[model samples]
Target: MIFKNISKSKLTLAFISIVITFFVWQQGLRDSLNRPSVTFDISQKEQEIAELSLQSIPVNLKKIFIINDPVDQINKSLSDVSFEELTERNKLIRIITSELNDPKIYKNISKDFENKNFKFLIDEIEKKSNNNSYKPSPDTFDLFKGDRFLYHLLSRKFDFDDSALITKSFSSKMFLKILAIRLIPLFTILIGSILALKILWTTIALKKFGWKEIKYLDLELIDMVLLIAGGFVVLGEVVSPLFSISLVELFSRNISNELSQSLKIFFGYLFMAIPPLGIVYYQIKSLNGEFNFKKDYLQFNFLPIKYAIIQGIKGWLTIVPFVLLISLIMNSLIDNQNGSNPLLEIVLNNNNYLSFFLLFLTTTLLAPLFEEIIFRGILLPTLSRNFGVISGIIISAFIFALAHLSLGEMPPLFVLGIGLGITRIASGSLFSSVIMHSLWNGLTFLNLFLLRT
Candidate 1:
């Protein structure tokens, strides 16, 4: 039990890490949650003035005023405007309404002028005209009847400028601060939970199994090929069409988008789970009908329930950092390539409540169970028996990652596969890997859920 003694020392270190992680997380969370709220009291007049000063006049107004080529002049005047100068309403009006009297430009001004300011300015011109030659168009005021800006101005309601607020909230430094506040605490807690479980399992495994009773499977090359092929056929071709229109039609006569999506995912999970479970049963039967449900069949015999939880935690913690790093690298590469991960796109875009629930259930529960049975339960031990432990784990992990058929996702999936492989070997139970897989998927689902919300 030299290995067990080493495990005990590792367990103590993991426990200390967990304690420190939690302390830091708690403090960060407290600070973030207790930050003061922001409030704004922008008045209607201020908003209206800001909008008029900032926004360019309508194209129709430019055509009418014969200012079709004044882009430079207008930009220069806007840039040079001071608060003191802007306070003079008459001067501000003159600056905005320049070049309205040229004959070439006036010829372009038709009765169809649609600018909001046109009617008001025309009325003023008519009042000042001694010859009474110009008249305001009857239809000019019709365009502003239900306008949002006019309604806001008339109502005199106080509101914050949304663009300004958004810009302020997402300034680079502020954004990074917020991200650190939220992410660090969350990751710390997750890792702490995993380490705590590992410590508990080390103590329990030492007492119960004494490291000798752990079972291993002997898998042939043919078994590996068949398992891999069967998995691809089921998950890729068979389960993929669960979202097809024809499949949705089979579920109900009147299928809404949500219902259709839910049924698709539901059937998808069923297809994924049944075939793998059958494979697992066949594998168990091939073992001379010797079934130790906990150790041999289910792979849950490394320790009692109390210590077994540690294996699950260790598996997840092992994969998380690798997954995160791979994800970051993949995202950067994808950005450079100007491409997207289709599976991620689908998960992100599909936000229906029932659809989300179905997706969550499939990924977190069904996927973990079936995938673990195939990869960890059947493949890992089999490969280990044929090859050395390290080679077997690496090979199995590679296959597991490749099964997803996503270049962007492969690295992280491989990392996850390695973690699960290690868990299966260390704990001597497939169930432990399954728990770890489930927790990892559950966390991924939760992260997506929070982001969408």
Candidate 2:
């Protein structure tokens, strides 16, 4: 009966995964179709023209003064100016001055050439050229202009080119690309969810079949508090200082900024991982023979691979909506803040592959392994035993969120911690929670990568 139930659940999950994959593929196709056909080449040419016209102003103005009709004279002067001569600032100035003098051409002038001082000059030219009898339309002059506004405008236009290129590059093979990008995290989530359910089912079945009561080491409340506090101090006081200031100063003196930064991140996390693991080991050792190697210590027990994977997927599914909601709210509230994880910022900004690899390793692998052991393996269980399950989960989860020291991120982190705690209890193994945490970080890393590319 249990086998039949498990088989049915697997089929349902497979169907859901297939449906989601199809939906994502369809959306990607729709996005590609709606993408703009425009390219950066047109904008680049316009910028060149604006620069050339600005430089040719003086020469064209001379022609404008010699002719009765400034519009025809300026147009003829512009047509004569060679592209090579446009590189000279003086020639560019002449061309721009000629364009401003002609009402018809000036009306269609690029906003790049319209500046406060330039407009004042144009008004002065009109007063002198027409003897205050004829005036160009007010629309030809920009009211609000700044220094080097043209350069700024060019930069802004160039920024959208990356996204435009991505849209244009989409093909029939896009489904394969999307699947490849998302596959690892999707599998991790699915397997984790399944493992969690299987573990719960197994525990219930065993209890009904007269399984013996599980026993844990007799840890005092003070013992739990001390261990937690010790880990925090080691991370905050010992590891943080080395990374934040000392290592940076030391490395800056000896190496390039890029190498120094990479070394700092690698060594910082290395040091951070050691101390917590050492502390946990020490605490377990202090329990003497009372600590059951297989069952009492959550980290020591090996959950069935299938059950572990299912739990991870379930935990991720439970927390994803809350994580997304908090992320949206936080982003809206702190819109000015760069919407990037610090580790992600380092990964994206640095060109050094070694540095990128080190950063990724620290965040995705080492951080998850050590943190899950400390929080879920040690803290959550200890707290649950001392303070009852609900209070322990809530309290430990709150501390986990607080440790991040980000108000904007606290809500999401807190929710994630709760999910991890629930998985710890349901699966009765630290490994399940570790898998979930790693998968969550992996998903976030992938998200940032997509946004950047």
Candidate 3:
């Protein structure tokens, strides 16, 4: 009906919609540039209560031979040695003290002494206790105390600067988790508003919009296809360029870097490449006639796959502007003890523009593919099944935010989570969610590159 009402005069309105979308995206990127990528969960599970040390003792006295000889026998042979003599080697002192306190020293590590390997230490301790002359030699006791000091010293940890991991609620870091719950729904509303506006604008243009988005956000088959295809293109064009197969140092900061990199690679193969080529490996056994839930969810008919992708892009173009607007607002508000901005640091963090580009590609492309598989594909279906669709969307969105571990997630992240979930449900396809998720992240990457610079 709107199209029937349109004339050449309306064509100008269509161009205006696209320009508005780009402006909003650029603004959001500028704001998000300074935001930090999350590294840990913000749930108020266990307060640090006290700082823990990470530096191990400076000494390497992991082993020393102290035989079970009598106190009189030991005292006579080592008469010239005083209590101070035992501590000559710091490592030796550590070993002696750790052994003296049976629980503190060998207790944790003893389990790892593979191949029936731990009997020697167990036997020595047991044998000493069995003998009547087990007076606990004075020099050995001194050695034990010194080692305890070293154990505590070497385990020094980074000062838990609550500043490094703060969420920007009106209150301090202590109450961030509580505020997050309340904020989740509000963020959903804001994101939904932005998406709706973008959708209307896209409709006015010739870009094509989706079917009436399920008011509650359920993706039809077509929605899924479009999301996957657009997201995949962005990933292939932007993300694949970040590959650094030979560089190890780039990943040094990542704890599960190797395993994560491998999984990312696997997903990249599945979604970004020609489908069923890899996905079919699962289906070859049952590909003949029956298409069950397993097949419906996992298997693909190329026609539907291609159709769905076209739909997803049309849907995304309409809604993308709103996503960009919220993201910009989310990124702009700053949080840091050192007053560091993630946006500024993007370039400063990587002296090599190539590395920065790699970071950009990975964030925009790779993360969305894997994340969608987990969140929209795996998590949303699982959660929606557990708690009706609405509950699933809320909880899945929360988990999405929590999944991204880092200090900087306090802002638009929760909103992004909700957006990702809604997009998946609305399209009734994981691809829709992937497009939205990648768009959100890609905007941030652009923030780092375009705005922060």
| Overall lDDT per candidate, in order of appearance | 0.53, 0.54, 0.41
Per-residue alpha-carbon lDDT of model 3 for 32-142, expressed as tens digits? 544433211111011110011111112242111112222222233233334333222322223323324444344443443442423333333444435524433333222
lDDT of 1 by residue, 1-453 (tens): 112233455455445544543454345434433431110011112223233223333445434322323333433443454534332332323333443444333223323345536544344443423333544443433443343333222222112233332243333333343344346536755775676476569768777422223355554555454445543344334554555546667766675676576666667667556655665567667765755555456565645875667778776776676677776686566532211233333454466777777787778778887888777777777777667678878999987876554444567788889878877777776778888999887775554443331
Range of the 10 consecutive residues with the lowest summed lDDT in candidate 2:
36-45
TM-scores of the models, in the order given: 0.54, 0.53, 0.36
Error of 3 at 290 (Å): 14
Ranking by TM-score: 1, 2, 3
TM-score of 2: 0.53
lDDT of 1 at 94: 35
Against the true structure, what is every candidate's RMSD? 18.5, 19.4, 21.7
In candidate 1, stretches whose alpha carbon ends up further than 4 angstroms from where it belongs are 1-181, 184-186, 189-214, 231-247, 289-295, 331-343
Error of 1 at 73 (Å): 30
